[model samples]
Target: MAFLWDCYDAWQRALAAEFFGREHAGQAVVFHIDDDVAQTIREKHQLPESLAQAVKPHIDLGQRSHAFGTILARAQALESEAQPPRSLPLLAVSVLAASRMSRDAEIQAINYFTPLKRLLYGEGADDNDRKRDALDQSFGQVVELWQQLDRWLRSNKGAFGVSTITPDKFSNRARIGYPLSQALARLADRQKLTQFFSDAEITPGKTYSSAYLLRMLDAWTNHGRKRFSRRFEAALAEREPAFASLIVREAHGWDGKVLDSGGSGHLLRLRLAFNHKRARLFWVAPIATGISGGTLTSGGTEIGFESDLSPYYEGIERLPLTPASIAMPLRVHGRAAAGDPLVAKYSPQEIILFREDPHLGCWVSQDSVEAHEEHLLLVSPEQQAEVRQVLQVATSGFVAVPPPLFAAVLPNGWRLYRNVCFEDPAALSRVSRRHTETAARLRPNPIGRPKLVGGLPVLKELGSHHYLQGGAPDLLLPAAGDGSRRVSVSLGGRTPRTDFRATGYPIPLPQDMLGPGRHEISADDAVLSLTIHERVVDDGLPLGTGTFGSMAEEIDNPAITPLVVLARRNATETAFVNCDGTVWDAITPNVPQWLHRRRVLENAPLYYEIRLEPHDRGWLIERTARHVMAIPGSPTWPKEDAILSAEARTDWAKLILDVTAPPKHVLWPVYVKIARKILNDHSR
Candidate 1:
C-alpha cells in the first residue's frame, strides 16, 4: 500500500506535459529507490537473467543518498521527442518489484505501469525489433497478451466510440480517437479494463502523451479496485450524503439484488445518483466538435445547427426525418383520420421546424418535432407561433424560452391540456407553465394585444417556405380589429385571385385550400406569402407520364428541355434511368430545377447535372428516369462524367462546392471542418 503511492507519485510527475506542449519542459519521473533497494534488486530479486544483469547498468545503485535524476530524465525524455521514449528501465524495475511484492502490491503494477510498456507498439513503431527485444527481455509472456488487446480495439473503433471522421486531412499525420479509449487501447491492452477505466479520473482536456495520462488512469483504477466501497461512500458523503445514506441504509434491500445480479442496464442508465461511473464518455465528439480551440469568445459555444440551406449545411432537409404515423404526410390515395378537426384541417401540416439539429443537444430526434404538428396545431394558429417559440429554446426538454414565457402563452382560461408525459417530477411542474405562457403569447388573447401573422394576430411567425405532405389545411384567420374585411388568395403574382369579399372578423372567416409552394392571401394590403413543401418519401412515390420541375420553362436551358424522368408502376428511384423521369421533391429551389441523370450501367455523374444540382442532398434523386445515355446508337449525345473524355469535351467548367459556414457565425469552425471533410472524402 505504501509502495503503491510511491508508484503513483513517481509517474504522475513524468507524464504531466500540457497537451501539445512539446517545446515546454515537463516534470520527470523521480524514483525514490535508495542503494539498499537497488542492491536487493540486483542480487536477491529473481528477475530474468538479462534484466538481472541490465538493472545495475541502467539503475543508479551507487547513489543511495538520493533519488536518481538520470532515471527521471529518461522518464521525461518525451519533452523533446514524439512517441513515448523507450520505457524507462526503472519502470521495468518498479513493475517487476511490484509483481514480486508480497502483500498489497503484487497485482498493482500490471494495472498501472503496464500500459507505458505496451505503448511502444502503436500506430507509429519505428524500431519495432529492438523494442520487442526489450519487452521480451523484461516482461516475458505478458507482452503478447497486451498486444492482442491492442489489435482488437483498433479494429472495433465504432464499438468504442472513436471518431472515424478524418476532418481536415489529419488522419495521414495525427490519429483521432477518444482519448480515454485510446489510453485504454494503449493501456493493457486490458480485456475488460476499458469499461472499468471509463470512470477513472484521467481526461484528455488537451493533455497528450499516454505516459502521464495512463499512470493517472492506473492509480484511479487501482484505488477503485482496492478500496471503492470506502472511497465511494466518503466521496458521496460530501456531495449527496442523503442519497448515499439512503442507499447505504437500503443496501439491505435492492442494492444486494442489483449487485448479486450484476446490474442490468436499468440501473446503469439512471441519471446522476443512480447511474454508474462505468458509462461511456458519449459527449466527447458532440462537445469537442463544438470547441473552437484556436480562439476564445463569449458566445462561441455552438450548441448545434440545422434548419434550411446554408452554403455549408445544404441538403439538410434531405436528411432522414422519419415522422410518426401521424406526422407522415397524407398519401394521395391513402385514407386516414385526424387528431382534431381544427388540427385535422391542418393535418399533414407542412410546418417549418428549424432545429439546427438534435444531434449535439438531446435525445429527442429532430424528426419527432414534425410529428407534433397535430399537437402544435391544437393551439389556435395565433398561439401556434408563441407555443413553437417556447418549444425551440436551447434546452427544449429542460427549459427553453423560460417557464414564465410558457405560463404567459397558455394562460388560465386556455383550458391547458396535460398531454405530454414527463418521467421527471421536476420537469412535470414546468410543463403547464410552458403551455400556459406559450398560449398567452398567442395574440388577440385575454393577456395583451395581438401579435400578427399575415393580416391576423400571431405569437410567432415562420419563414416564407412551408411544407405540406398532403391534404390542404384550412386557413381560418381573424382580421386585426376590423368588423368585416376583404380577403383574396393569389397563387403567386400571375392570378385573377379567388376572392371572398367582406369576410367577418373572428367569425364566418372562410377557409381556403393552398397548394405546395408560395400562396398569397391578402386582406386590404397585408399579404401572407406562405409556402408548404413536399414530405418526400421514396416509397409510394407519385407516378405519372408528366413532369413537375422538369417542364420546358423549369429546366436549365428552355431550348431543349425534354422530360428527364417519368414515374411507373412498381418503379424504384435510382440514378440510372432511360427517358423522362418524375422529380419527386421538385419545388422552389435556388435554381428552377436540375437534371440528376447518371450512367445507366455505371455509377457515374452526368456533368451538366452535377453543375445544376451541386448541393442537392438526395432530394432530387427521388427522380426516376427512362433514358440514361447513348439513346440506342445516338452518337451525338453528350457523355459527361461517366466517360473518361467527359471533362475535356464539356463546355461547362467543373463545379466547385462553395461550402463555408454561414458568414455571420464566425465561431462555427467545427461544423465547417466536418462539412469540408465529409465532402472531400466522399465523391457523392
Candidate 2:
C-alpha cells in the first residue's frame, strides 16, 4: 500500500516537472490561491449537480484549470495516434471509469481499457500478468518524463543566468521554457543570482538536483519582488561618476541613509548624499592598515582618495548612529565648512568636541583625532558638556574636554594651555615633582674643596654646599708648598688609618697620644691632610710581592696584610701605599695645567715625616705612625697685602689662622670679618 502511495507521489512530481520545467517544479506539486480569491469564488458560484455528483473527490480550485487542460491534451494526442474511424466515446468513458474506480478496483479498471493499455504497454500474456505489466509500464513512463525534464534543464544552462553560460536558441520542450527563460534573464541582468547562492553558501561544479534548483529559483523570484535593482540604480545615480562606474553592475539596497552593495561574504557601505546627488562607497572587508592616499577598485573603475576610510567603516560598525537624530551645527568654520552636512553631523551622545588644530580641524573625539580628515563640531555649550560626559563613559575613565569658544578672551599665555586637564590633581602634582627631582639628580657636583684643620679632616659649613651621600670627600691644597709648614696633630681623635703592610716602617709614637685628644696646631700656610688606614678586610690581598724574608715562609699563607694611605687635595684625593716587600713611590706633584702651578722654595725644610712600626715576623707592621712638620709662610700672604691695606692685611692673617686652627674652627665667621675689613679699607 505504501509502495503504491510512493509511486503516486512520484507520478505527480514527474507531471509537475514536465509542465512547469524542472527549475520551478519543487518535490511536490502545490497550487497556491489568494485567500480573498478563494472566498470570492465560493460566494459567487455553485457546482452543477451532474458535475458535482460525477466528481465525488475534492477538486482543488487552484489546479482545476491546469488539470482539465492536461487531461484534454492527453486524450486528443491518444486519439490522433489511434486515428479511429468511429470516434468511440472512448476518451470520455476512460476518464469517467478512471475517476469512478476505487483504489482496490484500479487494476481491473486499467485492464478493462485493454486497447489503450496495449497501445501504452506493447503486449501482455495472461490477465493477471498483463495487469501487473501494465502498472510497471505506467510508472516507467513517469520515470522517463522525469529524465527528460532533467536533460532539458541541463541543456538549457543559459536559462539559469550566470556569466559563464552564454545564451543560445531555446526549445520549449518542457512547456515551462518561457517563464524559466524570463526569470533567468532578469536574474542575470540584475546580477542577483550569484549573490543568492554565494560560494560560501553553495559548492561550485556540483550539480544541483531538481529539488534544490527549484528552491534557488523560488528564492530568486522572491528577492526580485523586493525591487533591489530599482533601488540600486537609484543609489548609483546619486554616487560620483568614478565610484558609480566601479559598482554600476552590482546590486544594492538603500536603507534610507547608507546604500549597501555587493554579495553575501563581502559588502560595501555607500554613504548617500542628503540631496541624493552624490555618494561615497568605502571598502569594508580586509580593512587596509596604514593606508594613506590610494585607489580602491570596484567592478573595473578605481575610486581614489587622499586619506583612509577604513576607520570610518569600522566606526560605523562599532558605534552605530541614528541617521535622523544626528546633531548638525548651524554654522561651521575652517575645513568643516566644506564637508558634507549629513556626514558632518554626529550624535553628541557618542562623541565629544575636541579642539580644532591647523592639521586636524574640529575633530569629533580622541579616537577621531588620529584620522584628522574628518571634521566634526558641537553647536552649543550644553551639547558640548553632554558630549564630554558621553566621551568619559566611552573612554573608560578619561576626562574629555570640549573645545572652548572663549580662547580669544583668555590671557595671552594661557591660550596655549591644553583645553583638557587631567582629573587626578595628585597624579599631575606627582609628575611635576618627579621631573624636578630628576633634573636635580643629573646636575653636576659643585667644584670646591674641603676645609681642613691641623692636617685633620673637619666638616665646615660652606654656603649652599651639596652633600654627596656616597664616596670619599674632596681635599684642597695650595699649589706651592715650602714644606716648612708645622701643625700639631691630635692623633687619637677620629684619625683615619691605613691597612697593615709587611714592608711598612712603623713610627714609634707614644701610646698616650693614641687615645682621643683635644689640641690645636697653627699653620701660616695651607696644610694637606693624609689619612692612613688598613685595606678593607673584604678586599682580599694587595697586588705586589710580600717582603723577601716573609714571602718564602708565607707564600701559601692566606693571612697577608695590606695597607693604603689616602692623601687629600682640592676637590680630589690620591692613594699611596707601603707593604712588606713593596712600597708606593712618593706622590707625583704634576698639577692640572688649568691650575696656577707654583714651584717649591729651594732648600725648604722637611715639614712632616710619617713612620710605622714593624711586626715580630719582620714582615707585618704595627698599627702606629708618627707625623713631623715645620712652620711655613702663608700661601695667601702675597695676595693679601695687594687686595687689602697694610692694617687690613694683618687682620686678615689673624682671621685665616683662627679659621684653619683645631677643634672648633670657625671659618665662616672669621671670613666674614676679614671681608668687612677689606671692604672698609678699599672704601678709604
- Candidates' lDDT values, in order? 0.27, 0.26
Superposed model 2: Cα runs more than 4 Å off: 1-397, 401-684
* Most TM-score-accurate candidate: 1
Q: How would you encode candidate 1's per-residue C-alpha lDDT over 392-421 as one tens digit per residue?
A: 431234222222323332322222222222
- The true-versus-predicted C-alpha distance at residue 36 of model 2, in Å, is 34
User: In model 1, what lDDT does residue 151 have?
Assistant: 36
Residues 359-401, model 2: lDDT tens digits: 3112223211211122232224333444344324322244322
Model 2 lowest lDDT segment of ten:
441-450
What lDDT score is found at residue 250 in candidate 2? 22
List, in order, the clash count of every candidate structure: 40, 29
